[model samples]
Target: MDGSSTTTALVKAARAGDGDAMDRLYRRFAPVVHGILLSRVQAADADDLTQDVFETALQRLHELREDAAFPGWISRIARRAALDAWRRRAPFTGEIPEAASPADSVESHRDAEQALAAIRSLPEAYRETLVLRLVEGLTGPEIAERTGLTPGSVRVNLHRGMAQLRERLGLREHER
Candidate 1:
């Protein structure tokens, strides 16, 4: 079966109280949800908000009219959760917090953080798309599938967002 058909089956099973199906759904879509949250909230909060979004989706699964609409529906939940989180967020100081694990090289961690910040600085459409494509490591088609964007729109967003990100990072076209 095709991917969407498989996803629809999983959603149907999940709605029927199948725990394994729910687990599989979570595994498949968690990155999309997390990327959505990251587009609107701090990275540190995105993980927790991702969980919250899924919990909310699961609780309201019966309200979802179409099984195939799961990706877009869950994405809307993630956006709402991220907005709520942003509303409740503590005021940011100028200081950037270190989020590196011990195994990560300091320079690489810093560079990653800087790149993420640049991505976040983009317009909302570009920001979310880029985060899904870049940070979440989703392909253009996968991003389009998960976010309900047309393939053309995803391609345009990726192109423009990359250009803006490169400008923000002072990188030439050849550098990438």
Candidate 2:
């Protein structure tokens, strides 16, 4: 069977209280959930929230109506988990807290986190696509399969997002 068929079978077994099936599903999708959470929250929180997302998905598996929708379903749960974490960390006063950090200003960590910050500064469409591809190590087709975006859209987002990053980092037009 193909990946989606295998995923659907696993989801079915998981829904029927198959612990091994759930484990398999978790093993398959953990990085996806982690990537989604990491895109929204800090790394430490992302790890914890990744567990939270899986636990929540397992507990609520019976509520999922279609196994084929598993990717989008779990992705939504991951997004919600990140949002919940964000909400818990904030005061309830209906105000948005700033997302900037002192670390972003230092620029000392020029390897990984700095690039992440530059990617984060892009518009949401670009930031999300870039994060899934770059940080999560998902290929363009994998990103589209998981996120329910058309393959073309994912390609466009990655291309446009990279261009913006090049401009921000002072790369010459020819360098691209």
Candidate 3:
């Protein structure tokens, strides 16, 4: 069977209380949920929230009307988990100053950590799209396919996200 059919079978088996099928589902989608949470929260928080997302998904799996919609559904749960964590962190929002850069300018030029921080600061649509593509290694088409977003929307998000990342990184438009 193909991926969809396999997922459908797993969903059905899981819904019927098959523990192995549920484990399979968790193994298959944990990375997707982790990537989604990592885009919005700290790495440690993302790891915790990824587990929360899957736990909630499993608890409510029978309520999922459509088996094929699991990806988008779990992604929504992951986002909600991040939001919940944010609410728990603080009731108010304030900016934190950036830390001092390293002395070695050459090494700093390709600072992936800084780039990831900038990506997290982007608007939700762009941040999620970019993280799904760049960090999670999903292609534009796969992103659209999994997230239930239109191809055009995915393309636009990627384009705008890249533009914002370039500007934030102090790269010229032509350099992109």
Candidate 4:
């Protein structure tokens, strides 16, 4: 079966209380959820918020109207959860705390942080699409499928978002 069919089946099974199916659905969609949260929330909070999104989705599974809509449904939940978290947090003070892992060099961590900050400064649509594509490694078609956006819209968003991102990062087209 195709991926969408499999996702539909998994959603159906999950709604029926099948633990394995729920786990499979989580595995399949967590990156999308995380990427969504990452685009709206601080990096440190995104992981926790991803778990909250899945938990909320699991609890509300019965309310989901269509099995095949799970991707879009869960994404909306992620976005809402992120917005709620953003609302609850204190205002940004132009300083993001350093969160360097032992394996990451300071320079790499700083670069990644700067790029993420630039992304967050973008408009909401571009931020989410860019995070899903660039950070989560989802392709345009996958993003379109998961987010229920038209393929053409996803393409346009990616193209325009990348251009804006390049400008923000001070990189010429040839540099990329």
- Index of the highest-TM-score prediction: 4
lDDT of 1 by residue, 73-166 (tens): 9989998888788788873332235643667777877787788778878998899999998889999998887777888999999999988999
The local distance difference test score of each candidate is 0.85, 0.80, 0.80, 0.87
- Cα error, candidate 1, residue 123 (Å): 1.2
Highest-scoring model, lDDT: 4
TM-scores of the models, in the given order?
A: 0.90, 0.82, 0.79, 0.91
Question: Please, what are the lDDT tens digits per residue for candidate 3 over residues 53-140?
Answer: 8889989997899998887888899989998998888521222223434454645545766787788878989989898888788888
Cα RMSD for candidates in order: 1.9, 5.2, 4.3, 1.7
Candidate 4 residue runs with Cα over 4 Å from true position:
92-97
For model 1, what is the error of residue 126's alpha carbon versus the real structure, in angstroms, after optimal superposition?
1.3
Superposed Cα deviation of residue 108, candidate 2 (Å): 6.8
Instruction: Tell me the lDDT of model 2 at 47.
Output: 84
Candidate 1 TM-score, true structure as reference: 0.90
Residue-by-residue lDDT tens digits, candidate 4, 2-21: 77898999999998899999
Between candidates 3 and 4, the one scoring higher on TM-score is 4
